[model samples]
Target: MKLLNVSAGKIQTVEIGGEKVRTAHVKMPRPEPWIITPDGAEGDERASHPDKLYAFARTGYGHWQAQLGVAPGEWNDGFFGENLTFDGLDETDIRVGDEFMLGEDVRLFVSGARTPCIKLAWRLNQPRDFLKTFAASRHTGVYLGVLDPGTVKPGDRLERVVHDPGMPSIADVCDYVAGVQAPVELMRRLLAFERLSPTLRILLGARLNAAEAAERAGRHHWTGWRDFRIGRIVEETPEIRSVSLSPLDEGPLCLPQPGQFVSVRMADPSGDMIQRVWSLSSYAAGMDSYRLSIRRQQGPGSNWIHRAQAGDTVQLKAPAGSFVLDPGSYHPVVLVAAGIGITPLMAMLEAHLARENAPAPVHLIYGARRPGDAAFLGELLALAAARDDFTLTQVYSQADAGDWPRSRITAGIVKESVRDTYIALDGRRIPVPWYESDIYLCGPGDFCDALRDELVELGGQPGHIFSERFEAAGMAPGEIEEAEVRFVRSGTAAHWSARSGETLLDLAERAGVAVSSDCRAGACLTCRTPVTGGKVTADLGDGSALLCIGRPATPIIELDC
Candidate 1:
C-alpha cells in the first residue's frame, strides 16, 4: 500500500492498561543510558533489520521519524508525527529483502511484526476508539527497518519487487483465515514456525488460533462448548456462590485429564465485550453436570457470573490447564487451600479418593478465615470420615476450632504433617510428580508465595513445585517518586522525577491519554511503545517493552509511547 500527503500528528493519545499515564512532558532525546525505561519489545524486536524504517519505528519503546513536512493522500485521524502512512501494495504481505521505492528515495521492506504493548489498547475520549484501533495502524500495520536510511517525500512512485503469487508461505495462513476456514493445524504450525515475521507470528497466528476455534469449531478441542445450569442455588456467601449444575446437555460428557481446566467464556449485557476464564471443581459425571466453585467479583467480565440465575446458560470451553493426575500414583498427597483455592482441589480430591491406589491418601491442610468460612465443609468432613487414606487439618485463624487450629496455616505445621512423601494441593499431581511422585498447588498469590517459599527452602526442586497465582498479593500505591526517563524521538533531552513503581501505561492512563492494553500479563504483546531513544528492562527475560507492565528503573529511558 502507498500513502501520500502526510505531515505531523500531535501526541493525541496515551494510557496504561486503559488508565491515563502522567509524566512531566519533556522534549525528545531525553538523555543517556536511554536503557532505563518502563518497557522493551517482545519476540524478535531487539533483532533489528536494515530494510524497513517503519519496522524500526515500531520496535523501540516509543518511536518517531523525522517528518520533512507532509505528502500525498489525506487520511489519518491521529497524526503521531508519522512519516509513511500508506495505502495499497498488499501491506501485510511485505517481507524483509523486499524493497519498495517510495516518494523520493525513501524505501521500505517488511522486517518484523509490530507486536503491541498496552499503550495501543488504552481507551480514548469516551473509549470508542479503543476497539477501533484493533483494525487501525496496530492491526493493518507492519514495521519497515531502514536499509538505506534517506529522506522520504510524499507522492513518490512506490514500486516493489513483487514475488510469484503461488509459494508455500505463512502469508498463505492469513488467506486461509480470511477465506473458508483456518487449518486445524494452523496454530500448531505457527507455534512451530521458527523466527517468523512478528505480524504473522502474533496476530495472523497466535491471536487467530483460539479465535478461529470460536469462529469455526471443526475438530478443534475447544469446539465442544458446554455450560448449563443444572442444580439449584445450594448456598451463597457474601462474595461467592455454591451452584450445583446438572448437565443440561444430554450428550455423554467428554472426560478430561484430572488437572485440566475449562474456560468460561461470556459476554456482558452490553454487546461490546470479550471473554474470561474460570476453572471447574467437580469430577466429570456422565451427562449430569457437576459443581463449579466460583467467587463473584467486580472485575472486567465477571459481573454476569455474580448475577447469573439458577437456569441461566453459560458457555464453557473444554478443560485445559496443565495441572492434574498422572498415570502412576506418587505418594502421600498433601493438599492446601487458601480461600477459593479449593476449586481444583475438590475435583482432584474426588478423583483421588475414587482411585484404589490414589498415592497413599492426602495430608489436607486448608486455611480459611474461620472454621465456619469453609465452603465445602460437609463434603470435606465426609471424605475424612469415609476413608482412612485421607487426613484433614484445618486452620481457622479467626475462629476457634476442634482439632483445627486458631492460627493461619504455617510451613511449620505443613512440614510436620506430610514431610515424608509427594504432596498434592487439591487434586493429584501430573507431569513431573514427586521426581515422578507429585507435588501440586494452587491459590491466591500471597498465600501461594508464603507456602511455596517455605517448601522450596525445605529443598523443593524447581519442577517439583507446581502452583497457580490468581490475584495480586495486593496493589500498593506506586513508588512514583523513583522513576526517571528520557524521550529520544525528534530531539534529545531528559526528564526526572518519574516514579519507579509506575508503568508507562499507567502514566498514560493518569495523563488521560488513551493507550492500548489487554491481558496485562506480558504474553499478549499489546501496548508496545517503541524504544526510539533509551532502553528499559522488562520482567520477561526479554528486553525493553510495553509500558503497561514495564517498570522504569534506569536513570534515563526512551520509548515511542
Candidate 2:
C-alpha cells in the first residue's frame, strides 16, 4: 500500500453513477490535518512523522439515526476511514493495541474496535442495525488511533508487526461450524489456525476457557462486583421497593457518573444465568452504599428481586453509560426524566447538595400515574423539604387523591414547572437550548422522542441534548460484515469498486485519494464522505459514508466531491 491524499472532516460529496449525490451527516466533527514544519520552519502538507498520521472514523451512520424524522433500520451499511488499506494477507488475526508498518515507514496499531450509535438510524435510516453492529463482531477490526505522524502517498506496502489474530479471529473460524452445521473441515480449519502462530495458541486457550464456562453454565456470564445490592427492601408503594447496595469490595463503586446503568445477571427456571440491565436510581451519596429504588419489572430478574429476602446476593456491574452528569460548568444542566428515570437524576442532585453544603437550588419535575404509583416519594420529598435550593413537583395522570395535581407531561406542563432553571434531556436537541443549558434526557424511546420535540420548541440546543437509550447493546456475527472496498479522491472525482478482500484505506491510497480518519471502526466521523454519485449504505446512521471503513453494498460507484 502506498500513501495518498489524506482529507478530513465531514464528507462534502459522494460521486455516484458519475453524478453528485448528497450524503447524510454523521453527527461528528471533521478532524484537522497534520501540518509538519522542518526544524522550526513553517508546517508543510506532508506527514510530520514517519510512524503515524491522524485520521477520523466515519461516525455518520450512527448520527443519521438520531434524525427524528428517519425510520428505524433504515441505514444499512457502516462508515470509517483509514490512511492505508490492507491486502495480500488475511486480516482476521489483527488484535487491538497491535501495530504494523504501512507504505514504508507509516506505523499503524489496532487501538480499539468500532462501536456505532443510533443517530445513524434516525439520520440515514438504520437504528436497530446500528446498535446490533455495535455489540457484534462486525464491530471488529482494528482502530489505529494514531501510531506516528508522517506523510503518506499511494503505492506503499504494508508490513505486519506482531501479527496475531486475537479471540475475534478464532471466533470467526468457529462460526463456520456453529449452530448452522458445517463440514468437519471447518473445525479442522480452526485447529489449523491454532498451529500457524503461538498467538493463535493463546487465542484458542482463551476461547476454550470461555466455551467451557458456557458449557457448564449453559451460557456465558461475567462475574464482577458491578451489581449494587443496597439496604433493606421496604415496600413504599404497590409496585416499588427501596433496597440499597454498597461498595462491598472497593474502588468507590467506581461511583460512576450519574445516569449510568449496571447489568445484573440472574438465574432462570432451568438455573441458567440470564442478564439484564438497570440504571442506578441514586448516585454515590457517601460511598457507604448506593440505592436502587426499583419498580417491579416483569422479567425473571425482577421477579427474583421481588421475592428475594434480606442477605440474598444480587450480582451487579458498575455504572456504565455516556449519559453522565455534565460538569455543569460549561452551562447549567437541565435534566428530564419520567416514571423510573428519576433514579440517576437523584444522584446528580445529591452530588450538588454535597458540594454546596447547603441546599442547592435545582428544578426537578417528575411524572407518575398516581401518588401511590410514585416510588421513592418520601426520599424525593425529604430532599426537597430539607434543601431550600431544590424545588420538586410531580404530575400524575391517574385519578388519585394527593397533594399533587393529576396530569401527563405535556409541553405546557414542563414549561410551567420551570421558572428559569437550565434544562437537560437524554439526547441531542432540535430547537436549540434557549438557555443553552446542557440537556440530559433519558427514559424509554417514546419519552426521549416526545421530550426531544417539546424541548426543541423551547429552544433546546442540538449539541446540548444528550440522550441515553437502551436497545441492542452487543453484536452478533453476520450482523455486520467487513467487505473489500476502495475510496478514491482523484482530482475532484472519487471512484470506488468491490475491493475483493482489501482494506478501503489501502485501495483509496492506491487510487491516489487521501483520507484523514481515526479509529477506523465506524464510530468516529473523521472519515465521512460527501456522496456525489452512486448509492452507498451505512450502519452508522449516515446517508453518505466513511470510505476508510465501510464496504460497498452495491458493487460500483463514482464520486465527484
| TM-score (all chains, Cα) for each model | 0.44, 0.43
- lDDT tens digits, residue span 17-49, model 1: 222332111112211121111111111122112
| Per-candidate clashes, comma-separated | 106, 131
Q: What's model 1's lDDT at 187?
A: 51
Off by over 4 Å in 2: 1-231, 247-252, 328-331, 357-360, 400-405, 422-436, 470-561
Model 2 Cα lDDT, one tens digit per residue, 1-561:
223233322334443222232333332222333222221111212111111222222233233344335454453222233332222223245443456665544566543333222232334344334444433433222334345545444445555576554324422433321222323343334435422322222223334433432243222223354444445778867776767664444344344566666656656669787566666666543355656666787767667777776666566754455566643232344566677777677676665555422111455677778777877778878988886556677878785324346666665555555535421221211221223345666556677778878766664545667765533321111222333233334653334444354344545656667776433334334566765544445423444666545545544544432
How far in Å is the alpha carbon of 48 misplaced in model 1? 61
What TM-score does prediction 1 earn? 0.44
Please state the error at residue 524 of candidate 2 in Å: 17
Worst 10 residues of 1 by lDDT: 35-44
The 0-to-1 C-alpha lDDT of every candidate, in the order given, reads: 0.48, 0.47
TM-score of 2: 0.43
Native-to-model Cα distance after best TM-score fit, residue 440 in candidate 1, in Å? 2.2
lDDT of 2 at 152: 43
